[model samples]
Target: MIDDAIRVLAGDCTVIAEDADRSEYRGRVTTIVKPDNTVLVHDIDGYQPVAWLTRADSVSSDRTGDFTLVAKKDTQTLRIAAHDQDGFAHYPTSAAGTPVGDCPDCGGALVRSSGVTCVSCGDRYGVPADATIRDDQCDCDCGLPKMRVERGLAFNVCLDRACESLDAAVKQAFDREWGCPEPDCDGDLRILRRGGLIAGCEHYPDCEVGFAVPAGVVDGECACGLPTFETGSGIRCLDATCDRALEGALETEPTADD
Candidate 1:
């Protein structure tokens, strides 16, 4: 899906456009919602649900604040915003586009001339080829990952300090399971992914467990017969050859450490 996700500077209160008829907001300038086309918002509830606004004006920490709009409909697109209130700025400020080099996506080394194909991923820039591209594999320095299998599978977790959006990851993990794994535990677990191989159980306040499901990567059919997800339990099989007694047997466990 084309994710129109944006990260604004994060602020207190924010709103987005819900429908074309913004009449309900005629005199309610405090609607806080934005127009359909979300302009740029900074230092408020950064783009999460996406609020469309026009030229935003007047920001106040006080509950009672006024904005500079000729009338409610005059700038109905404007949305009132606030920061996280956690005594910190937004994760990545939007004042200026981060430098490509400094950008986490671009990473450190932007230039690498090692091979034609991406040796690390084996993906050619445009087409698939036999030759190996050495550059971005292991930073321009770590080099391409060799075929030699390590002693144990390192946990699939990415321990990056910056990549800390764990909520969605955890939800995806639970979705992989489709529900809870513990037979006796009937309630249901909330999945939260920590960058590393293990994901945190959504029941953080209570049930704190870690898992190793690759969030959305459908591997294959579990021995049981159900389609196996990255870190899901056994597959659900109904084939005459399949067995439901032994947890269906189709469910595969983590073969490697991760």
Candidate 2:
């Protein structure tokens, strides 16, 4: 199964499948290449993949302007052929952009190869397209670039682990919106790692507050004077305690055009 977090490269192509029983199936299909090198051929209408090849399966490609990808596993074989010279477009996991910083693991410069991956260690850090990387250092005394991923969420991250700004930034970002939920503790909640959705408290030893972040939460604010996450259901408050408040606001609020 493909993890929700894993991005896929997809395109339209022709697929030919040969089974061990000597049966053959051929059709036009949408091909999705996963990060793990697994290939899935799906029908145009459905989400299910009609044919697939595991990463362990032997794969070979032949290109003559256009390209043909062949995968074989035991007696089963799958072939995907591109009709046009540029029938398929290669969508990289990372967009073309400037380097963020030096790799913390290897000290080599970090480039956006596949979402801010390290050139030396190949460690991938997810930076959304709109993520801001400024030339100036943050106020936290880390002297590292200030990176804000989600716009409405004020969380800024310092990619360098040696810098002490990350915890401080997190504390400031979530201070007014949501503090550490731990009882009798006042530590601020913040994101401990870059490209991750988990938020932990600054007071790790004393108050270990953590939670899974919902999608589309930004550093910006809503009319409710709290940070919000744009979920599929609707806008929701970052504080779980304010769920009922958000629901009530959504029910009463009217949409206005700018």
Q: Which predicted model would earn the best TM-score? A: 2
How well is each residue in 1-258 modelled by candidate 2, as lDDT tens digits? Answer: 112222232344577777754434445555666556677877666777887877626767666656778878777788877664334545434333567776545676667544666555555555545556665555665444666655234556664544534446544555444566566878766655545545667787677666555545563344444456775566766654554465555455555952
Q: Give the alpha-carbon lDDT of every model.
A: 0.32, 0.58
Structural similarity to truth (TM-score) of each candidate:
0.23, 0.38
- lDDT tens readout by residue for model 1, 1-258: 112223223334434433354422121112232222234433325444333345434332333332222212343544343323312222211122211122133223222233222222222122111212222332233232211111011112111212322234344444445334444444343344455434344555465544444424444554543334432233332122434453444344657773
Highest lDDT among the candidates is held by which one?
2
Steric clash count of candidate 2: 8
As a whole number from 0 to 100, the lDDT of residue 75 in candidate 1 is 38
